[model samples]
Target: MAEIVLANVSKSYGAVPVIEDVSLAIGSGEFVVFLGPSGSGKSTLLRMIAGLETIDSGTLTIGGQRCEQLPPGQRGVAMVFQNYAIYPHMTVRENMAFGLRNINLPQAEIASRVADAARILEIGALLDRRPAELSGGQRQRVAIGRAIVKEPRAFLFDEPLSNLDAALRVRTRVELAELHQRLRSTMIYVTHDQTEAMTLADRIVILNERRIEQIGTPLEVYMRPVSRFVASFVGSPAMNFLEVDVSRRGAERLVTLPSGAALPVPIDLPNDGRYELGVRPENLRVVPSGGDLVGEAVIIERLGDRTLIHVRLADGRSLTAQDSGRSNVAPGDRVALGIDRAEMHLFDASGRAWHPAQAQAVRATETA
Candidate 1:
């Protein structure tokens, strides 16, 4: 296992920039995932690390060695691609041994490595079968097994589970996590799926528009996003945002919504200005009596475990709240909703985040 580092890394095709000034350090034996939208440069960054794409500027270091200029073979990294690139006519054993054979390793050594990889991947039983006869998940395992037999210093995966069905994807995800645990090698995985990123990564790198937005554990980003973009991008139902005006209510600051309901926020304002208030669906509760906000339920979606309520506020802004699945709330009900003061998020005019202490202060003064 080795550490990977990128300093001021960038990529471009003529005048169009794909990635820009991205710097990150991946610890040795750590699993890092690059997550973003389709055009967000996640794949481009992965390719740069694998030496498939040239870095227009910046430095890349792998295992304490400068590797930006090295060829893919000399970089000591093995890649598992999305297509499960296996020769259909060759048996799994022959497929896994092909790379080693090209380098002219001793016959005994090649057999030992292939056998060890097949055993590790639990593909020893199917070693003699051709790729045409294997299931999607099994074929992917073969691709990974091929990488393992190379005995690389690190592993790079580019959407390796995309071809599998939903059930197979989950199973393969678990297997990949176990493989990392057993090998304890540095692995960089790229995927556009947020669920995959949340479940698989030790730390997630969120990229957007040729730049990185934030890098943190899944819960950290979900609980306290540093920007409005991250707050909206990281959550499943996405965060709810409403525009409000800030005002001084006695010694404390309060945010008055367009609906004329004033919410005590825990933040200090330089002046009465416009800002966006963010709340997660789980943080908003349906109240039996009264609340600081009132809205009409526009839609209700009931999942097995939870119910999602989409409420259109008096001012015509919409917000969603999550309730217990067993709770019977129908569409078109006039529902009162309360915000959990401790779980609120406030953003400045520029979309940058404010500390929670500010939000707490506002809530305290309002309650007082």
Candidate 2:
């Protein structure tokens, strides 16, 4: 396995820069995911590591060797694409063995490698089938198997599951997690899907514009986002942001909603000026009358075990709360919403967040 490192790396098209001064160290045998929206340079960054995109400045090192100028074939990395780039005319076994032949390995060695990869991927039964005869998930497994046959130091997956159906995606995702655990190979996966980033990554690198926003674990990014953009972009149904006034009384911080209701929060207050309160849907609860904030439910989304209530406050701000699945709240109904102070996030005018004491300490350490 190899530890991949990028030091102040940058890329640009003429005067338009795509990636700017990004430095990251992906540990050996670690699974790190590059997560961002379209045009966020995640795929570009992955390609840079693969030698498909040239690094304009700084360094790219793999296994302690500088590889910014190395050819893709010599980088000791295998990449799986979103399209599952396998040969349609070749059988699964042929497709996997094709890459090995070019390396001048003995035929028996190539067969052994292909057989081992097929066993690992549990696709030995499909080895005789052509790409045309395989399901999308099976074809993707074949693509992955081809990479495995190379026995590269690391694996690069670019939205590998994006092409699968929902159920197949779920299954393939589980298989991938198992593969990582089994091989313990260094892997860098790029995707815009938050679910993939959240579930698959040992650490996630969130990119925005031409820079990285944050790097942390799934729960860390979800609960302690360093910026407003990180908090809003990493969660499903997104986080609800409300303009709030904060005041300090002794050691406690009191957050006052626009409706004039005050709730004591565990976070420390920043200096004067309004802060945005970020609460995930799961952390917001609906009360009857006399809740902290009063609003009218404008939309209700029921998803089996949970119900999402989108409420419009008196001041015209909207908030979504996750309620009980059996709760009978409907649109047009008056609902009182309470914020989970313990789970809330406070974002300053600059979009930087102040999390709970535990998270703040960790954030401070990272900065230090």
Candidate 3:
């Protein structure tokens, strides 16, 4: 019963608030990721859960026991840090056994725990090596092994893969996922990398400016973002924003772009002032002739299998569209982008997002 809950938990550094009125429940044996850019307080939130930082205004409970005022060791959570916090002066075995030794556990139990963790992390062969002698990935595994010996209720990881090389990072990320499946332990990982969050977490908690913007499964957040900030931040190339006017003409709901091109998007709106049309690069297609949107190719990014075309619209704003690797479209070439209504997202002045399906459902309900 390692379920964790935070009820109106918040933290502040003087007058500056880091985490404010955040409440969430993490099911036992679930893998959750805190994702956001630097200074967004993802790590701070994780630290709060770890008891390294004091909670300012709310209560935290781990496995149904209040832990906000508890010491980190008493909170029933183990943390693996970005810096492999394992002692460099000690061998891998010694580093993994250090915490157990501090508690004056039976020498046999300490040795058994250390041996089991090493075997689980596949570092049993390197148990006698110091941190300097081991590779970055191996050292990180040692750090994790140190945490595993505690048999805590949950695990906390703060950008543990950041120090590894790109290839190694990918490899280690997969290893972590496998390890989670093996242990089925409640793990809360903190990372700014969306790729890591998308691939690793069962659910992602997206934070921005010291506040949580959204929390959902990867596909849910990717397919249906709640706000413009979320839509823009979650994807690789990010969502494109085009200023447009929404108005009702007869029975047709139209979105008039800056270039006077109208997209017939039948969605519920006030049809007042300017709104932002959100579309992803993959949703926009480069057509041969006239399309829903017209633009000129200003940049062509050629990856191995795909080419990304940066289309500069008539209004001077640019958008990224995907094309095949063999695409002959060059810079300065005239191109038009086609988009489907179902794939489009509309954002009001307040930055709230609405999809075609959601809007139609709302309209149907209103008319009913």
Assess every candidate by TM-score: 0.94, 0.96, 0.96
lDDT string for model 1 (217-302, tens) is: 98887787888988888888988898888888799778887678788776665567888888999998888868868889889989
Q: Using lDDT, rank the candidates from best to worst.
A: 2, 3, 1
Q: Sort the candidates on TM-score, descending order.
A: 3, 2, 1
Candidate 3, superposed: residue stretches over 4 Å from native: 360-368
**Candidate 2 overall Cα lDDT vs. reference?**
0.92
The candidate 2 region of ten consecutive residues with least summed lDDT is: 264-273
Candidate 2 segments exceeding 4 Å error = 358-368
Q: Which candidate would rank higher by lDDT, 1 or 2?
A: 2
| Cα lDDT listed for each candidate | 0.90, 0.92, 0.91
Best-performing candidate as measured by lDDT: 2
Which scores higher on lDDT, 1 or 3? 3
Cα lDDT tens digits, model 3, 35-133, are 988888899999999999999989999998999999998998999999988888999999999999999999999999998898889999999999999
Clashing pairs in 1: 265-362, 266-358, 266-359, 266-361, 266-362, 267-358
